[model samples]
Target: MISALTIENYRGFKNFSMNKVKRINLIVGGNNIGKTSVLEAIMLIISKGDPQTIWKIISGRGEIVNYVGIPQGVIQPEISVRHLFHGHEVKLGSAFKISAIMTQANKSIDVDFKIIEAKQVDQILYASLPSEGMDTFGPKIALSITRSDKKNPLLLSIPLSSQGTLKQNTLQTLVNINFQQFPNEDERAVFQYIPTTSLTGQELISMWNAVALTAEEKRVVEALQSLDDNIEQVAAISSPVIFPQFGQKTGFIVKMRDLEKPVPIGSLGEGTWRMLVLAIALVKSKDAILLIDEIDIGLHFRALSSMWEMIVAASNRLNVQVFATTHNNDCIKSLAMLKESEISIQRIESFDGPAIYYSADEIRVAATRNIEVR
Candidate 1:
């Protein structure tokens, strides 16, 4: 797991550092404070010098406009990371700096690259640190989903670059992107980034039914199906669907639940989709870093507490490290309900021009008194 992540001269942040990531890390701050940029930095660093892949993961579309904000037309953003294993400390450094000189008409940016590993450079096979029982892939797995904008929205069945191009090869799963071509309007993409196993609410219910519950996994499935409000009950249905694969073109026909047979994903009630995605991600994201932004987007106040319980359990079972951002105080309160074993919470705030990260204990200290470090 990453012990610390450092960023310099990247989107909204001249310099930022986040350390001691536990099972669940929550970033709380105002907009444009680089919360998402921190996540983007992880994805870029893990891409290991592949600008194309980095661009796709960060911006969805491979566009230069996303990089326009960087001071100086410099490309290849710089990032550094520290990883800890057992008793050993491994420090990885990079200077993928860019040289851009502004001019009257236009400006130019040149990308430069530098890297250092703990021991010998040549001995390292991948760019990221290696962990036991897990493939580091030279960097960490950063799953990011940005909300949609009015002009350039994402579409359903959006083509994965790897699905067609030679250079397009990635081990990530993005689902439920919707694009529509209206007769009057010039094709609008409704939703931005929604990651879930099923596309529709009906499909979601079907998936819930399809889950071949083991004696242990059954407890989780039962808890999810027996929700109080909106979701009267969850019933599984049979369906032939294409399951997600990391690097291969392998898919399976599985059973799923129909959460929308009663209503559309747009109407099935808020947080329904978000909760479903969280459940599925927790189950599927074994040994991977799952990034969830604005986790409390939808759902009633009561649902928030239950959702946290489910999330905490899933992370522990799957051994997945989760990074999430939220501004909801209620969501934080819900997390406080968890037992020590259920979830480990790390509170981080962007203040005083930089990010201040704290462990659960440290956060308690700051909260006990009127300690506004900002």
Candidate 2:
């Protein structure tokens, strides 16, 4: 588990630190206070500065610029690296670093991202460039991951276009090459990030397939039962080829205790789907980390406590560390019902300001006093 985390020159933060990180840490703050950025930073660190993950973070926010008049076969989206820095301007040496102290190892893990000249990278990486005679002498984005136990850092870089932005296809080619060269880079830990809207139909199908017929699948069913006790079994069925549109949108069907036939998971409501996503994510991230943004999106206030309980129990049993953000008061108060040692809350006021951390006891007191932490 992370005992503490520090973010410097990343997204909305110039310099920020959160202490007393526990097994399950809930982040609370006002809108646009960089709550979600914190999750992205953690994801970057866990992924060891993966280029594809970086692009996902940028494109997820609609930060990419679409270009027209490009050749028919060429990718047209471009992502600016400047938006990732604190000042939103990328100059030589401009960099951001995310570091955390692991309680179990009593050591720190750091991932540094910086802008550098393209010439500094190996020429072999440029072989996949387009044949349109695009210049490869411009600046590039470089990433380096350092661990306390390792002697050398793991390095990766992607070239930038003459416009000083990352082209979609260029990045994809570089990522493909690097994956083949270093296939086991992500063997360290399993990291899963659940966005605000939750997982999609295909995403849920993939996750369900990973744990099907295993003990983890049982946990997922139990989580669904929290929303509806009659939920007996859950399965991901193939989308019908003849009438794909008529099939379950999420490709999941549930067998109810009293019902004669299986019902589409979408028929159960948003809460059921949200619970399923959370449960599958927790199980899939066993012995690793799970990050969720706007965790209370679709559930009723009455179910928030049960949701937290399930999260706490599954995280403890699976040895997974969870960091979730929420603005719901019911979600904040729900933590008070859990053991104080197992949870913590971090509150942010602004991007460049200090973070206020509350331990489990402090959270319990705040809940008892009806204080507004969110």
Candidate 3:
């Protein structure tokens, strides 16, 4: 688990730090105080500065800039990648960094990220391609990761065309440092980020496919059982021709004791669907990291306690480290009530100073006493 984290010039934070991290971290803060950005930084580090992650963050914020008429005139997006920085400016020498210290027993790995202008990025991304046709060589950002031996760091190429950048696919192509492909046993890590208000049946199905029939699937079913004990089974089906009646929306199916034939998961309430995706994500992220945004999106206040209870047990059982965000007071209070020794709350007030952490007791106090932690 991460023991400490630092973010510099990412999103709305000029410099932010979260120390003494625990197994389950609940991040709360005032609106626009960069609460979600901290989760993004953590996910990026865990992925070792993955290009898909970069695009996910930008796309989630509606920062992708689509082109108008020019098909191949070699033009970069009008909005530069600098928007991720402190002043929203990205000169040739400008860069932002995210680093974390992961600790287990007596061993630890230090993960770091440096986001800088493409020109400033070193030749770490294999032999440099000819810079001739590069899109005016503007201020495109390149992300590099260095957990150890910065001399041989992994470099990434943002997916946006060097010749011309459109809004779509702003960041892509993560090279080197895929821990799964490396020879070292200590470097491998599993990480997944589930964005807010974007959970879909198809996406949940795909995640389920990654680790189905294993102990993870059983944990998922048990997690959903928190919502209803009658939820005997859940399934993900693809290309249902004979069941063409399922049509294109035929992705998730759930079996309740009352139902004769299995019905589409959509027949359930939003809380069920939300819990389904959350549980799947949590289970598949076993012994790894799971970052969730707006974790309390579609659940009733009364259900938050039970939902968190199941989640906390699953997290402990599977050794998954979670960093999730929610703005609701009931969510916060319920979360505090559900906390074991594994949880802590980080309240992001602003970037003017470092992040402030609240103990589980403190959170409960704030909730019961009607105090404003945000």
Candidate 4:
């Protein structure tokens, strides 16, 4: 687990630091304060600048720069990776730094890289991006994502100009991440970001397929039961007539004691699918970090306490750390009622102010006293 996180010269933040993090941390604040950017930083640090996340963040902002080869080839970064820089400016000597320390040991990771102009690109060493009316390599940008435990670490350098130059062999996962503490770690610490709204039928089905393959299905069912006790069994169903894709992903079906036959998951209500997706995500995120944005968006106020209960229980059971954001008072008040897991309520101020931290007891007091932590 990470005890502290430090980010410098990243998007929307010239310098930022947040300490006193715990097993389950909930970030609360006003809008446009870079809450989602913090999660993106954590993802980049843990994944060691994986290109998938780079595309996700950029495409999430309506900027598409990924290219594919003739027939179903590896996805490569285009000229758009420069969007990662602060203010979308890719000037030389401008860089970003992200570091985190382990909570139980002295192990830590420091990742620092800068943007530099690449005038020449050799096909053997790096890929070349071709652009119109340019020099030999079409004004390429070369940057390497390198990390280590003070030893010889892994380095992945890619060119930002060429289309078909990048392949699967050019990029890789982080090596000896977290000071080599997890040299053999099964999964990366970072997971995909679950949006605030409920997942679509296909999205939930995809995640459900991942969870169904593991022993965590029972845990997911237990989590859904927290929201509604009538949930008996949850299953995935697919047919040529019912699904658009042929068995690639399946929709959900649930068995209720009152209902004679299995019914479609959507019939149970929006909250059912919302809570179900959260549980499935938790199960598939073992020994890793889960980033959820606006976690309390779709669930009703009455289910807030129960939702927190399931979240903490599953986090402890799976040894997963959670970082979520919200601006709901009921969500904050219900957070204080959780007894199974430790909580850290952080208040992020706008304009690069220091983050305010609050303990569980302090949060309970704030809720009872009607104090505004936000």
Best by lDDT: 2
Top candidate when judged by TM-score against the true structure: 2
Clashes in model 3: which pairs?
A: 65-167, 75-164, 135-162, 135-163, 159-171, 159-172
Task: Please give each candidate's TM-score.
Answer: 0.52, 0.89, 0.80, 0.82
Question: Residue-wise lDDT of candidate 1 within 1-374, one digit each (tens)?
Answer: 44456554444444456654567766677655656555555554433223333434434323222121223443332111111011122223323322222222333222223223323332232232222122333432221212122453211111111111111112221211111222211121111122212234433443343244644345444444534333433333344543443311112221225343443333344455566556755554555566776777766778887887777777787676677777676676666555543233443354224456655655545445544422
Which runs of model 4 end up more than 4 angstroms from their true locations?
Answer: 65-79, 119-139, 162-192, 197-215, 238-250
Clashes (backbone N, CA, C under 3 Å), per candidate, total: 24, 0, 6, 3
Clashes of 1: 24
Q: Model 2, poorest ten-residue lDDT window?
A: 140-149
- Whole-model alpha-carbon lDDT for candidate 3: 0.68
lDDT of 4 at 4: 85
Q: Give the C-alpha miss distance for residue 153 in model 2, angstroms.
A: 2.4
lDDT of each residue in 97-176, candidate 2, tens digit only: 99888888898888888776556344456665763434545444343334333655646666654444777777767767
Residue-wise lDDT of candidate 4 within 1-374, one digit each (tens)?
78888888777887788888898898888898888888887887777665555555665655554454433453544335555667776655557777888776857787775655654433333422232212354445555556754574534445444321222223332221223433332354356577665455666665666688566787778777877788888987764244545342237888887889988777777778778878888876777888888898768998988888888888898888899999899999899877634788888885365678998888888988999987
lDDT of each: 0.42, 0.79, 0.68, 0.69
User: Can you write out model 3's per-residue Cα lDDT over 46-128, one digit (the tens) per residue?
Assistant: 76665555556766777745534335665543324556767765444456777788777434444444454555443443224
Cα displacement (angstroms), candidate 3, residue 155, comes to: 2.9
On a 0 to 1 TM-score scale, where does candidate 3 land against the true structure? 0.80
Residue 71's lDDT in candidate 3: 51
Give the Å shift of residue 35 in candidate 4: 0.7
